[model samples]
Target: MTNPCDCDIRLIRIDEVIEITGLSRAAVYRMIQKGEFPRQVRLSVRSSAWVLQEVREWAFSRVSPTGLVD
Candidate 1:
C-alpha cells in the first residue's frame, strides 16, 4: 500500500476554495446546499475545510473544453 503523502489528499480552506473556483462565498454555500459543490468537513466548532482534490475535480467537471458550463 502507498502512504497518504503519495496521494493528492489535501484540505483547503474557504479562501483558497474561492480563489481556485472563482465562486463567491455565498455562491459556494448555495451550491453545497443545492448538492452541487463538494461537501465540507467540520474541522472545529466554527471552522470547515474541503478536500482539495474534490473541489478541483468538481471545478473541472463543471466547465467544458471551451471554459463554459456544460
Candidate 2:
C-alpha cells in the first residue's frame, strides 16, 4: 500500500509540476490565475513553487469518489 506520508510533499518547481500534471507552464499559470489550481509560494526574489501536499490533495479531490473538491 502507498504510504500517505510518502506521497510527494515537497514544494515542487514548475518543471516538476509540468512533468507530473502533463500541463504546459502557461496552462498551469492560467489555472492559478483563475483560482482553479493551487498557487505557488514565493521562495526567493524570483523562485516559486507549490506545496506537493496541496497539489496532491487537489488532484485527489478531482478523482475522489465523493463530489467534494476539498
Candidate 3:
C-alpha cells in the first residue's frame, strides 16, 4: 500500500467554497444542513474543511444537460 503521505488531497475552508461556487454563505450552509451539498469534515472543534475534489465533482454535476458550460 502507498504511504499516507503520498496521497493527494486538497482541503479547503468554507470561505474558499463560497469563492469557488459563487454561493453566499447562507446558501452554502443551508445546502449543507439539508445534506444537498458536500459537507465539511470536522478538523477540530471549531474548524472544518472539505475535499477539493468533491467540490469540483459537485460543480461538474451542476453542468446543464444542454451541453453549455455555465
Against the reference, the lDDT scores of all candidates come to 0.93, 0.84, 0.88
Which sections of candidate 2 miss by over 4 Å?
Answer: 1-9, 64-70
Q: How many residue pairs clash in each candidate?
A: 0, 0, 0
> Which predicted model would earn the best TM-score?
1
Clashes of 2: 0
- Runs of candidate 3 with Cα error greater than 4 angstroms are 1-7, 65-70
In model 1, where do residues sit more than 4 Å from their true spots? Answer: 1-6
lDDT (Cα, 0-100) at 49 in candidate 3:
97
TM-score, per-candidate, Cα-based: 0.82, 0.72, 0.81
What's the C-alpha lDDT at position 61 in model 2? 62
Put down candidate 3 lDDT per residue, 1-70, tens digits, no spaces. Answer: 6658786888999888988888998998999999889999899999999999898888878888886667
Residue 31 C-alpha lDDT in model 3: 92
Per-residue lDDT value at 48 in model 1: 92
Residues 1-70 of candidate 1: C-alpha lDDT, one tens digit per residue: 6776787668999999999999999999999999999989999999999999999999899889999897
Clashing pairs in 3: none
Judge candidate 1 against the unseen true structure and give its global Cα lDDT, from 0 to 1: 0.93
